[model samples]
Target: MTNSKVGHRIEELTTPAFLLDLVKVKSNCQGMLETCKAMGVSLRAQTKTHKTVEGAVLQTGGSRKGIVTSTIDECEFYADHGFDDILYGYPLIAHHMPRISALTRRLEKFHVMVDSKLAVETLIASQPPTGKTWSVFLKVDCGNNRAGVWWEDEESIILAHQLGSYSSLITFRGLYVHCGNSYYAKTDVEVEKVRDENIERLLNFVDRVKERGVTCETIGIGSTPSCKKPSDNMKKLDELHPGNYVFLDVQQSTLGSCIVDEIACRVATRIIGHYPKRNQMLIDCGFTGLTKQGEGMLVTGYGIIRDNPNLKICNMTQEIGYIEPLKGKLDFEKYPVGSLLFIFPWHSCATAAMHSVYYVIEEDKVVAEWKPTRGW
Candidate 1:
C-alpha cells in the first residue's frame, strides 16, 4: 500500500499527520543491530511498533531476517512481503490456529508463543494437513508479571517437557520474555538494574529447563528500555526483540533509554485558536492525533511540543489540543494562529496506531508515505 504522492513538503500535507524521520529511524535500527551484534545476539526486530513493510526491512537490514509481530494480521502482512521468519509474540489462542496453520505452510519459519497447556493442546489438535510442525516458544515471565508463566514455577518445567514431547506436531523453539517493567525506571542505574535482573532470571530459568532435559534453542529478552541501555549481562541472550526504539517517545526519553533528539516520530499540527488571557493555545490535534499514554515522568500531559519543550499539551478533546506553558507564563504572541508545531508523543506505538500512514521526512521535506498494516 504505497502512497504515490511522494516528495511532498511537510507543510503542504494535511495537519495532524504522523511524520517519521527516515534518518533517525535508520540510525536507531542500525544502532540496535550493531548493539546486538556486539553482544553476540540475533536481532529479531519487533514490528508491532512500526507495522510497515518498509520499517521491517529497514530493521532487518537484509540480515538475520527475523521479525516479531503482535498480531496475526501482521504475520500475514509480513509473510506476504517475503518475510519468512516471523514470531507472533502474543500468547496463542486456539481459534487462531487455522490462520496460523496457513501461515506455517507459507512461511519458511513461523513461531508462536505459549504459556499454558491448553494452547499447546489446541495446536496439536489443529495440526494442518500440510504436515508441517508448529514452532513454539514458551513465554517465561521474567518479572514483568504481565503474561507467561512465572520463571521459577514448577509447572513451567512440566510444560516445557510436555511441549518437547510433541516431537511430531510441534518443534519447541525456545524461551521468550519481555522486560516491560524497565519502562517504569526513572534513572539509568534503575534501567540497567532491571535489564541485568531480567537477564539473570531468564538465564537461571533456561538452566532449570535444560536440567530437566528441555533444549531451549533461543533465549529472547528485551524491551526498548532494556535493549537500548543494556547491561553487560545481556551478552548471554540468543536474540533481542525491542520495538519502540524505531520511534522513541517521551516515555523512552524519561526512562533514559534515549534522549529527546533521538525520537524519530512526531505529529505535525497547526494552531487553530489562541487564548491570550488564559495563556493557552488550541491546536488541531488531540487524543485522536496523539494517544494519551502517560508512561513516564517527563510526560505530564498528552504530548510535548518538539520546538517548545516546556510547552505541554495540557488537555485534549477529540480533535482539539490545549497547549500551555509548564514552567512560566505562556507567550501567546510567540505562537500565533495557523502556526505549525511538531509534537512528540508520550508513547510512539500508541500514537502511530492512530494514523494509517506515516509521512517520511528527510532533510526538511516529505520523502514518502509509508502505510502500516491495520486491524487486529
Candidate 2:
C-alpha cells in the first residue's frame, strides 16, 4: 500500500520527506467536525489540501460522503473510490462538461459551482445523463473576489434566477462562498470580523435571491480561518467546507485557525552543511519540496522550523534551502550535520502539492504512506 518501503525510524527516511502526523490529523479533523456540529451545519470538507483517500475519509469522519474538490479530476477520483455528494467547487467551463456529465450520471449527488452567465448557459445547453440533472450551486463573492459572482452585483441574482429557471436540466442547489478574505486579518477579532461580514453579506444575497423567486436549498461558506473559529451567524448556513484545517500550516496558525502544534504536516529535512563563515546552513529541501508561498510573510522565512525559533529558512534553491539564525551568529555545534529538522510549512496546500507521497507517521514510526491525486 505504500509507494515505497518506509523505514522504521523517521531519521532513516530520505531527506525532505513529507511527514504527516496521523494523530494530529485525526484531532484536527475531529475538531472541525465538532465545529460544524456546534454551528448546526453540514461539513462538506474540501479535499484540495491533502487529496489522499485516507485524508478524505478522515475529513468526512469515515462517512466518505459530503466533500468538495477544487478540480474535476478530484471529483472523478473520489467518485471512482465510492465517495458521493461530491461538488466540483470550481467555476465551470465548457470544456469540462463531458467528464462532468459522466460524474453526474455515476454519483448520487454530484454538484458543480458556477459564477458566470456563460457557465450557466453552458450547463443549460448540455443535457445530463438520461433522467439526471446537473446539480448546481451558484458561487457568490461575499467579499472574496477570487472567483464567484459579486454578491452586490445584479448579475449574481440574474445567474441564480437563470439556473433555477431550467429545472429540467439544472437543479439549482443553492449558494456557495469562499470567504478567503479572512486570511488577511491579523488578529482573531479581525478574522471574526471578516467572517461575520461575509456571513451578513451572504445571507443578504440569499434574501435577494429569494426575492427573485428562487429558493436556495443550501447556503455554504468555506475558508479554514473562518470555519475554524465559526461565529453564531454560521448556524444559518447549511454547509461549511474547509480543507487546510486537516494539515494546518503556519499561515493558519497566524490567522488563529490552529496553533503551531496543531500543524500535522511537515517537511522532514536534514542539515547537510554548515557554513559558520557566513553564519548559515544548508538543508536538502528547496522550492521543490516546500513551496515559496510563505516568502516574505513569515519572520521565520519560508517555513517555521519546529521547536527552533533561532533558525529561519532564509532562501531556497532547486534542491537546497538556506538557513540562518534569527538573531545572533549560528551555533553549528548544536545542529550537527545529518541531524533531523522538521519544518512546518507556511501553506500546507502548496507544500502538499510538491510531494507525490506523504509519510504517515505516528510516534516517529512510519505507519503508512498517503499518495495524493495530482493534476488540475
Instruction: Give the per-residue lDDT digits (tens) of candidate 1, residues 172-220.
Output: 9999999998987879899888888888989999898888898999998
Identify the leading candidate in terms of TM-score: 2
Q: Candidate 2 clashing pairs?
A: none
RMSD to truth, every model? 1.8, 1.3
Candidate 1: residue 265 Cα off by (Å)? 0.7
lDDT (10s digit) by residue, model 2, range 168-226? 99999999999899888999999999899999999999999999999999999999999
Q: Which residue segments of model 2 deviate by more than 4 Å? A: 1-3
Tell me which residue pairs clash in candidate 1: none
Report the C-alpha displacement of residue 314, candidate 1, in angstroms.
1.0
Best by lDDT: 2
- For model 2 the local lDDT of residue 155 reads 78
TM-score of 1: 0.96
